[model samples]
Target chain A: MVEQSEQYLLTAYRETGNLQLLGRLYEPYMPLVYGLCFKYYKDEAKSEDAVMQIFESLVAKLRVHEVSNFKSWLYTLARNHCLMDLRTESRVSTVDIEEHLVESDRLLHQQYEEPITEERLALMESCLEELNEEQQRCIRLFYLEQKCYKDVAAITGYDLNKVKSYIQNGKRNLKICMERKQE
Target chain B: MNNNYLIIRIQRYLNGELSREEMYELEREALDDPLLQDAIDGYRLQQRVSHRQLSLLQQRLADRITQQTKERHAFYFGWQRLGVAATACVLMVLVLVLLWMRNHPDPQRGEKEVQVELAVPQAVGIQALPITGMAFDAEPAQGWKAFNAYLAEHMGNELPKGEVLLAFTIDEQGRPAAIRDTEGAVAELLAEAKRLLDNGPTWKGNTGKIKLIFR
Candidate 1:
């Protein structure tokens, strides 16, 4: 039903130049666009701006492109737009470097690659509970449900940066809590 | 290995930004490293938001577009109203012209005859007048006051007040033969007065063409 309505709106907009139809067609996917922007820009304001900018471009772009799956197409377009925006800004963060280094060293030295036992999984669950509410939610959605940051942001109504932070902090806290139990 | 570079690579891999070879290497490393797998899991969570946000954004965009459409519609409607008003004014002028033509047929011809009669009212006289010519009685013998009162009642506020001079003849049947020599407001008053007199009492004699002045 939704797809048919979207198709009708698309055709109507193309024929009539009615932006209202276009707006209706695009309305269902705004949060996804916002989430994608949030992921790329990691700033609430920038993400919101990106969502609006993407829509502006879509006015002309949709006319040219034969989009079969609007959701996936929109997702890719939004991601690429954000990537281009980030590239133009040239402002990559350096904070992830030290943490990545420590993680890499730990991975290389660890010998036993045992599957997580039921006991350890239980311990992990308890540790997960120990984290703050946002962190626990983000970490569970990301790790247990295998959802991406954008999805987590959409689900939780969290800003992209906040979702990422919660997950990262949650992971660290869970690790510390489990290690302490082992000791 | 520069773990910062490794982490960046992992991030890129999670974002699908990595090439095939880089992705393979990252996948291989993550297989054995539980912590690295956990990081990948955490990164993957970025893709799992609900569908509700799209609806919200759509509503906002629709509202903006709706507002714009309304403004354009209002502007167009304003111009449309002006066009309609202009058309009505032109139509009213045309109707007035048509009505005036119907009321005063062949005005130029009437004016020319009246001018000739005014130039020689005495010489042309009542005997020379055409039998078919119609005129108003300038002076009625009996009940003249009653006639005036009737004229006032019928003509209402539109009746021409003040003195009027008219040139006309009476027929053998005591009816007006012709009306002549008048212009402007007097012409209009005389035309109206002629209708009232024609419908009223008849005069007695074949009176010659006479100029009658009334106050």
Candidate 2:
């Protein structure tokens, strides 16, 4: 897939002046972008809109989008666009976040063992049920939404270090719960 | 990435503290080390799961984007396409209005033939260097492949099956002065020619070529 993707990239860039290939190459990873937007705003409609706008401009400018990794470029494009949309709308005004993020996503070639099972996922869910509201939201914000620690801190009224502590602790507890369920 | 290095990298990566070299190094290490790979995998998995697991997100986004783009473009161009249904539209009227005034031409806006000068002059007075066959990729010359790849990267598109003809001027100093190619990227081809001309050890004359092609 990587080689084929590279072939497509080279062909797309070299054969046609169309920068639209960046969008096709990046379509599979839109979930990550949407997921991040949803995490911050908790609104699917706006998140979808943000993702759309990002790709629209992104594809048009693909000819000059100096990038080695397509994944990271897509990630950054979506993230930056999403953040910009968020600011222009001012809906996340209450959800004070610092440091506008724009980074690339790299497609992983190797498939690693997803040791997580249904039972483990269920246990993890239950662990989430047991956590305090702030901690759980932080877990989702930091881990799932790809929000920074400072953003998490601002969202949930936790300090910077406290945000990290909550995420680390949540993961630890989730692992422990899975281990216990296996036992 | 060993267990220790993997953990450190993950933390650093998340914090956005890792340099580009370190980021690349971490990525390569994660690719090879199964244990480190597992940890990074776990980290990403955890991130995804936490992101609320939305499917069909890309397609939906694309559709929405396509919609928004159409709307925005239409907003600006609404009146332009409003009355173009019949052949005798307002544009014909406007053109007739302008042509009638040609007898009484606007002295301020004189219709000077608007002769735009060409950017790259025609490659006159220079003989083309020769190649054996139509295929350029087949040629394994000293710097042909390098030049090909470099030009390919800059051109941002693949050259088609037809021969790409470029016309360029060579100065007295043997440097390529100007280049022009409508079918292919002019700049890229000129750069490739310049690179080859620079590195050639046993060169003969100084003048650049007109219509340098794969054929």
Candidate 3:
């Protein structure tokens, strides 16, 4: 339902050339863009600037590119823009372009494993129940419902960083719990 | 302790914060262990959340755009008002100038033939009387023919034909003064005529540049 509404807004913005429509389309995902920028730049001001700059660029770019999934596409585009900016700035720092390329290559080459067996999946589910209330909610919303961290935070009313911490801590606890059950 | 460190490394790897070597080691480790791969999948889920704090960024951008739009509209409206006011002032000034021109006219403009009409009394008896004051009765006691006949007899046939323009002023004592003709031939005749006319009656009001055109 949300995806359909986003698609409708994207189409309306393209047809009408109304920035307000574009603004509505981008507003929900502003946190994701800012978070991604913060991860790259690490400076609060630079991250904020990057989020605004990404939207400005999106106005011209979204018109040309045929995007299927706006969220994933926007994520990749924002990451690329930040990576490029970091690459340019890295000339002044000790970080080399070769290291960035190697990291990108490693991420690209990484493959996913087969789905967990039915018995292991059952064990994981029971282990999930052992987590704290906040962790349980954050894990269910993020891993099962497939909501982004920002959406999870919005639904759970947790801070963005707190949501990430909960999910991370919960995942570790669930793994430990599952291992003990196997032993 | 090793498992805790590994979990931290997996989280960092999902965030793209892992160093190139650490990332390569993690990828190799995950490939060897199916349980570690599941943990990697869980870590990837945590990376997707966008926090509530960044909504402030969106608000600020929206405000800036709205402010710029308002300022542009105000600038355009200001110019529009100024243009309207300037046009009204120009029209008002034009109307005032037209009214002023209509009220105060040029005396020497258009008509060249100047005529001055006055109330002259008729001669009662052929005798000159001493004028007492500036004010007197303008109604004639007798007739104008006798006064004109007396002037013709004194000037004889020296009065020119065609048109003779005589200019003079009636003094405060109701006596003719500064009697002169533009044609020098009728100057003496005009003086005699003025004297006879003055004797016939007392002039009461202003007789300014009286033109006597004798044709």
Candidate 4:
């Protein structure tokens, strides 16, 4: 038999108020939630606590909020919860620059949908040139050469995080540049 | 892909175990999915997620769900269980009362039974014969009350229906001896009276005359 999807479990939990169904829906995402929490608190114990707390909040919040996409909604919830905790503790942690670089997947989805015509390809190539030197090089190594992020970081003599950030920023800039060219 | 596979792939990516193509594919996917991207970043910072800790958390979640179910069952059926217990108690008391009533008849009925016994002798009249009363001519060595009781007990219900006079003297052991029937009672009656006085309780040494009337 096909395993019940998270969507099915969510709907079942909502209708029946069965906590088991909700637990089933929430359990799979615990690792990701824990990781996300770690990004903020940077402590394993606090991150674990936040993962459980996020599930607890969802028990009530999911009832009130109409979630179109559970995964995105849950991520937003986890991030906001971590931020609120930090705010209460009167501590400051730097917000990730990658967060602002890619706000949504609309550009990526559009790019993937449109056929790679010569004009589109030419525009994307020009947009690639507009990125900073580091981003341009990382993006080309990762996308064009089909190199992994590790190989890209090794070749560029940059930190893994730095390489990932550069490529992410490069992809967003390239998409924005392509959109501007089209307009 | 399933959650486990995705997590394992992320772990492989972090551990540098994924091949170049696989790593590129995961990186490309993470670009479009911020959740996955942040998770990859979180896993990178943490180094790795302990399977043991995650399973422990899952166990805690399962326990919470089970605990809620137990509380609900107690809340919903608790009153029903109490009601059944109360009904059983009432039924048990009722049965005990019924059994008690069966074992003991009414007090008024017991009194009625005694009245019936009293009425039967009167209705016959033949069994109404009475042995009036007895008198002592002189006080014996033993008390007159005791002597009368001894005589009545020894006689049982076979008291002769006549008056008999007897004379006797107490011996050294306080026994009545040398008995004679002064009224010339029947030989059998005299012999019986003699035997009763001889075996009766000891009295003070004295001359004693006794009379008994039975009618």
Give me the candidate number with maximum TM-score.
Answer: 4
Q: Ignoring the other chain, what TM-score does chain B have in each prediction?
A: 0.28, 0.20, 0.29, 0.35
Predictions in order: lDDT:
0.61, 0.51, 0.60, 0.76
**In model 1, what lDDT does residue A176 have?**
74
Given candidate 3, what's the lDDT at residue A105?
37
Q: What TM-score, to 2 decimals, does candidate 1 have?
A: 0.31
**lDDT string, candidate 4, B72-175, tens digits:** 98987998899999999999999999999889977889999888864653322111111222432234555766666566556535545665677777777777
Candidate 2 lDDT tens digits, B1-215:
13234455666665567875565456445333322333343344344332233345645655654665677688768756664544457678889989878877765454332322212222121223333333321222334444444333333234332233544444554444454453554565455544544443222233323334431
Residue-wise lDDT of candidate 3 within B89-182, one digit each (tens)?
9999999999987997756653332322112222211222222234432322233344344443443344454333444456777665665655
Q: What CAPRI-style quality would you assign to candidate 3?
A: incorrect
DockQ of each: 0.09, 0.04, 0.06, 0.33
Q: Which pairs clash in model 3?
A: A148-B49, A149-B48, A149-B49, A149-B50, A150-B49, A150-B50
Candidate 1 chain B, run of 10 with poorest lDDT = B123-132
The predictions' CA RMSDs to the true structure, in order, are 21.0, 34.1, 20.2, 17.8
Ten contiguous residues minimizing lDDT sum, candidate 4 chain A: A100-109
TM-score of chain A of each: 0.50, 0.48, 0.53, 0.86
Q: Stretches of candidate 2 above 4 Å error?
A: A1-7, A10-20, A92-183, B1-58, B61-215
Winner by lDDT: 4
